[model samples]
Target: MSGIVTELWPYIVLILVGYLPNEVWRMLGVAVSHGVDENSELLIWVRAVATAVLAGVVAQLVVDAPGALALVPLSVRLAALAIGFLTFLVIKRSVFAGVMGGQAAMLIGGYLSGVSLMVP
Candidate 1:
C-alpha cells in the first residue's frame, strides 16, 4: 500500500500542475467576460495576437521540423500552407478543413518529391 501510494503521488502532482494554471485562468476569464462586449477593442486585439502567435508557431513547424518532417522541402510546406489558407478562406475559416487540406497537400507533395528523387 505504501509503495503504491508513493508511486501514484508523482502522477497526482503532475496532473495538478498541468491543469491548475489553465483552469484558474479559464474560470477567471469566464467570470470577467460576463459583461464584456464580443466586439470590444481589447478582445479584438487579443484575438489578433493569438492568431498571429498561432501562425508563427505553424510557420516555425513548417520551416524547421526535425526527423521525418525535415525531409519535405520548404517549398512544399509553404505551398501546402498557402493551399490550406485558401481552403480555410473558401470554407468560411473552418480549421478542420484547412488542416486536412494542408495535410493532403503535404502528403501528395512529399510522395511526388520522393518519387522524383528516386528516379534521378
Candidate 2:
C-alpha cells in the first residue's frame, strides 16, 4: 500500500494542481454572477470570445493535426465540418447531432477515399 501510494503521489499532485484553479474560478463566477444579467454586454462579449476561442481550437486541430490525425487530408476535414454545420443548422443546432454527423462524415469520407483511420 505504501509503495502504491508513493507511485501515485505525483499523479495526485498533478490532479490537484490542474483542478484547483478551475474550481476556484468556477466558484468565483458563481459567487459574482448572482445579479448579472444574461443579456448584459459584458456577458455577451465574454460568450462571443469563448465561442471564438473554441472555434479557433477546432480550426487548429483540423489544419495542423499530429500523429494519426495527420493522415486525414484537409479537404476531408473541411467537408466534414461543412456537412456537420449544415446538419446542425438544419436540426435546430443540436450539438450532439452536429458532432455525430461530422464524425460520420469523416468516417465515410475516409472509407470512400481508401484512407485508413488507424495508425499503422
Candidate 3:
C-alpha cells in the first residue's frame, strides 16, 4: 500500500546509501584492472583497505545482525573467528581448514543456543 511504501522509503534510501559507495569501488576495480600490476602500491593499499572494511562489517554482523549470525551470542561468534584465524596460522594459511573450522564452530554454537535453524 502507499502508506507502507511511504514508511519504508527512508530505510530503502539508507540501504542504497551504503550500497552505492561499495559499487563505485567495484566498478572502478573492474575498470582499472586491465592496466594495473598485481604488485603496485595502489593495489596494495586498495587490498588492505578492502580487507579492513570487510573485517569490520563481518564483526558488526556477528555482534548485532540477525538471520545467519543471530543464532549465537557475540562471544561465541568472536571465538569462532579467533579459532578460524588460529587454524589458518597453524596450517600455513590453508583456506579450507580455516573455513571449515569457523563454520563448524558457528554451526555447533548455533545448535547449542536452542535456535531452530531448520525453519529458515
lDDT of 1 by residue, 1-120 (tens): 999989999888877997786689889988988988998998998799989999899889989986778888989989999999888889989999999998899889988888244533
Candidate 3 stretches with Cα past 4 Å from truth are 1-23, 29-42, 117-120
lDDT of each: 0.87, 0.87, 0.83
TM-score of each: 0.62, 0.67, 0.61
The residue ranges of model 2 lying beyond 4 angstroms of the native Cα positions read 1-5, 91-97, 117-120
Winner of 2 and 3 under TM-score? 2
User: Positional deviation of 9 in candidate 1, in angstroms?
Assistant: 3.8
lDDT score at residue 86, model 1, on the 0-100 scale: 87
Native-vs-model 1 lDDT? 0.87
User: 1-103 in candidate 2: lDDT tens per residue?
Assistant: 9999999999988779987867898999899889999989989988899899999999998888777667678898889999999889988899998998998
TM-score for predicted model 3 compared with the true structure: 0.61
Clashing pairs in model 3, backbone N/Cα/C closer than 3 A: none
Could you give candidate 3's per-residue lDDT for residues 22-79 as a string of tens digits? 7898898689898889899999998999999999998887778778567577877888
